[model samples]
Target: MLRSIATFLCLRCQPVTALPLNLRSRATHSVAENQQTVEALYDLSVDIQKVRKLKGWVLLQSPAYTKEVAELLKNMGASGPIIAHILTSHPEAVLCNPEQIYTQKELWISVCPNQRELVGIIEKFPASFFTSSSHHDNQRNNISYFQSLNLNKRVITKLMASAPQSFSRPVEHNELMVHTLQQAYQELGGEEANMKIWLQKLLSQNPFVLLKPPEVLKENFLFLRDKGFSTPQLLHLLSRLKGFVTELNPDSMRRTLLYSQDTIGCSETELRDIILRCPALLYYPESTLAERFEGLLSAGISMCQITETPTVLELTTQIVNYRIQRLKARGYDIRTGSLEVLNGTKKDFEMSFGKLQLRRERPLFNPVAPLKADD
Candidate 1:
């Protein structure tokens, strides 16, 4: 099919006296300004034909760039869907010189241990190859910086894959960012091992941290400390919560803290425990918390019970109520073992009690959902 289309395009491409005004810009120059070989080949008519033939990511350059990229891939022995994906996602990669592309491929292959693995990484992130070439010095310094923070190569590569934009910064800027993160680590009683631990937690919890402003991270780190999170507790919650990807506002953080302290009546130690055990509680809206609590109460769960098993608040009320009631109807005593019932998985609960077998109440319950309290 592609051959037929290319043939049709070649037949259609007659040297024209004038290109359309809208298509003229594309005919002028490519993203690769220094490469002069394709300068005379900037026949917009021919590129339009190749792009149409490709039927995927449209190449903005003339036929020369597309042909050269295909030739480069052929030389690398890359075939199959990988080639199509690389072109569609980062068509601009063709802008890199053949030598640059070859250099990047070799660099990745050196680390990847196999040809297929190298091609897989490039397929997902073709720009990875381009970034490695012109920025080897900066890349080395960045790797050392991550190592200084105790990130292993695997972890560093994971972080880079998630947020490649981090490599776009120069050595000086990345160094400043590293210093800011290290300072935050230091402020939190940074023992040798703890520095590595804290930095890795921060990175894994939020790969986007490498892309975030250092000041934002600094502010959030201090805010948690001001809220009385111990060093370890802060590290746990900081990564688990949205703060890793976003700047957590003081007001919002304070609101979660106050709710846990006032409404939940969590003691300082208990608050810390709750934050670490269930850091996601901070992101829940008050309405959701209230609704979950209300469901527990409506189903005869005491305030004391809810407080003791705060994690239960995370589960939907329907599930809790259904599981408890189902267990009760099956000759089990829920009042005596409510804690385990609420904490355990829904699958186990269903497995133990069988399929919520209430013929009369079937219509009222979701086929796959837990039964209503009354049902």
Candidate 2:
């Protein structure tokens, strides 16, 4: 007698979409028919090679449909890991009607006209196409949902660009997330304008902001609050650098803060003030953050000058070196800040030294009328 098929099978080997009882009964027969059926299963699917090693495991359905799916993917130019990922994640995709895949492709192509751009979108969001047409349309409709909020098309594009996964979420779910964010702001005594500005920050600095639970956002806000940001400075940090505050580990932020204080020999209040003025410093690498500050200190630059133009810290090493060397070699010290030396264009730099662009224009044709009048 034939050994039980269950003896060699895994739990996941169960039929997800089994054929009818009568079909299974009719297909069963002597050892010859069973052997042929098992061979056919292995022969049909390329990803099903492990069956060769199995004692009695077999594919429940004919691989004809799966082969068709693979061919359809190849015809549509799907490559390598993307194809394997789709098949592995959603085996039902093999049973999907070709028209469904075609329609989905057309939908994305309409929005992303350039072939290369579509490829990039697909690479970033490869799982986007591995679902039923209805599900695909639901995710595609997310952009429309953003539009319904009175957001411009450009904002929608930017949202998708920043986080393509955002498109995969349901519209109502994201709207609810946004609503929670707005309610949180209102509860905190923020104005209507505050909500609008916050929404802009969410769209740019963290497109996935809407995906996070409301509590997480609240926690991050509170953490930033503990760090001594006023309401305005908090808004600015959220607007300019969401990832630094939310995505970065709190311990790392604390270490960076501590390192900066120890290196610069500044008080906590002074560091807070500097960060409030230029939040970018909070996100910069701890290792190199001191170079600009230390170099400026050696050049006799003061804290007041840095406080006035904090962007000086962001200047390139080349610009800082040139400015410092130029100053030292020429026997002059930086009186204020190195704003012009670090940032100005060549023409602007020359103009800062009192040099100006000369101008010329054609002379008027006044002499011809005067000559006629004299004659």
Candidate 3:
């Protein structure tokens, strides 16, 4: 494809007088510029065909100053293959003119301590680095606003790389969301000194929360409140959820709660207790809850046992089945016993399974031990 495009550009480079006037008017970009872009990309070892497949019109329709982009990256300490990978991964980046890219670099430099770190960020998140010029002021204002809040440069840099949309919007947009979070923290009796730490942790856990509307957060709070969660309980839930509370809608939460109650045969009070133990019960949709519930039942795991250890539902049905099979092979009856052994991460499960194996292999009656004591 690159060769074909280059050949076509060569054909178009013929003297304008050699072609009809109608054809001469059709050349949007000078053939010289198009040929140069392609040659630069090839020189840099970029997969030109991949870029064309990802964004076909990049070279023909847009003024892709790929050589300037490579030069800027090289100045930032990027190596040859890293630049090629960035271009291959996000071909649209070449559409950015040098001026816009320089502006973006200055904005990022305000948060990044040095060029090396900026290159690392670009290498990892190319799309985030090549933002549109239209977002320049908004990105600048948001960075300053976060700095005013005393957020470290590293955290601000992370926000840019991980969730650039949050920084691209107007500063007022983030202000409203931050204010809502602050108010919620204060209402929950959070200490003023700890509020910043809490806010930082929440944002680090899920930066995308900044992209959601403030009203969604408020509505989720109201829904949890109506479900009998006090303000302190709501704060606890938010902390346990790692600030992903905003991801849940009232309708989904309600559905999950109802399904949990029906499957576990638990009252609203009991359901609340289970949700406090495993917030996934409140976050997962009905379909997920249903699949887990059916798997537990099929494995002869009683609903009562499930209620006792609601965290077990966090594992998918397949994982549950596999773990159950392993335990059964070792003669551990999951149905007759508690579900506590299967309620944790992989390391936790291994440790618990090892203990069960030891228990199963221990001698029930050691008659020879009494003879030794007598001797």
Candidate 4:
């Protein structure tokens, strides 16, 4: 019985021995396969390097993987020459993260090492790669970004600070303080020309006259009055509103002059005289003001003042109606009953008028029809 038990134990141990041999064999085979794969990968990498060197291809290695470079390479057929040139030209391309070079709408070439070389590469590349207007636009944008990065902010600030202020402030005068007195001296009953002269005399002592000649302050006053601005309201609008309109609009200047005219009840001729008396208002026109005003108006600023008074409202309605009637006189359907007029904004009315005039002025294009063989 003891011999039988020993034999059974030996059989169990035999199975355990076979299990170890099978595991050892499997492990050895796996190691060999892995070694072979690694060797094959090494050989392929070597061949790739040889191709790069022979073709003068630069090796572009990013510190981290870059989808932009990968995509660029893929798109260019992963050409060895192009890759080598890009790598050699931009050695530091790999220093930045992929995100630094990639934008949603554009694929920018790296400009880390040498900008001139990068430009050259771009120029030499197949026209198909960057022939589209959008691609050229991307290149221009990238170049601008690079230039901005290189710009010295401190230098720019210093230059701006050194520049002189373009416009001088209004001069103060004791005589100009009496609005009633100024109104009594004006001719033409509140014309812009007369009021300008009065302001000049009143502000003669002031070194800088904010109100200029030929630009009546009373006309500006009247314009503002029509728009419903009180004396304090006009002041508030001039000082508090921060925008292109306030800074650059001649209409704003004109309105201010009108306001002064109405405030003093001076004539246009008097205003011109006032401007001459106060020479500061005669400063040269700033080129930027016109552009700035256009931008402000484009941003949907209805700066032309409107008054809530019944009489003024009636006048404004009449003016608008008259303008429409004038357009209709020229055969334009500008009446409120017309579909275009009903659907259009004030801006649209002007645009339509311009378009209509352009159409009439444009030469006709008439192509000869192809002749039929039977005919």
Highest-lDDT candidate: 3
Q: Would you list the C-alpha lDDT of every candidate in the order shown?
A: 0.60, 0.58, 0.85, 0.36
Per-residue lDDT, model 3, residue 54, is 59
RMSD over all Cα atoms, model 4? 29.9
Alpha-carbon lDDT of model 1: 0.60
> How many Å off is the CA of 87 in candidate 1?
3.3
Put down candidate 4 lDDT per residue, 64-156, tens digits, no spaces.
232344344446355545544543343233233444444311433332233343344443432212222333443444334323434233221
Model 1 ranges with Cα > 4 A deviation: 1-57, 67-79, 89-92, 106-113, 126-137, 147-150, 230-232, 235-247, 259-270, 284-375
Write down the TM-score for model 1.
Answer: 0.59
Q: What's model 4's lDDT at 238?
A: 26
The candidate, 1 or 2, that scores higher on lDDT is 1
1-375 per-residue lDDT for model 2 (tens digits)? 234545334332443333364543223322322344433333333343333233223333333255566666656676655555555444545555777767766656645545555545554554454445666655678866776666645456556655656676677777777776666556556688666656665666677776666566667677768987678767666556653454554555677788877865678888887777676676677777777777767667786676666767776556676765654544445656354444455455445433211211234565556555554
TM-score of decoy 2: 0.53
User: What is the C-alpha lDDT profile of model 3 across 23-97, one tens digit per residue?
Assistant: 422232345336656667778888766655555456664567888999999998999999999988887788899
How displaced is residue 306 in candidate 2, in Å?
2.9
Query: How far off is residue 309 in model 4, in Å?
Result: 12
Off by over 4 Å in 2: 1-102, 105-138, 170-173, 187-190, 210-214, 242-244, 291-304, 315-336, 340-375
Alpha-carbon deviation at 41 in model 3, angstroms: 2.0
Lowest-sum lDDT 10-residue window in model 2: 353-362
**Superposed model 4: Cα runs more than 4 Å off:** 1-98, 101-231, 234-242, 245-326, 330-375
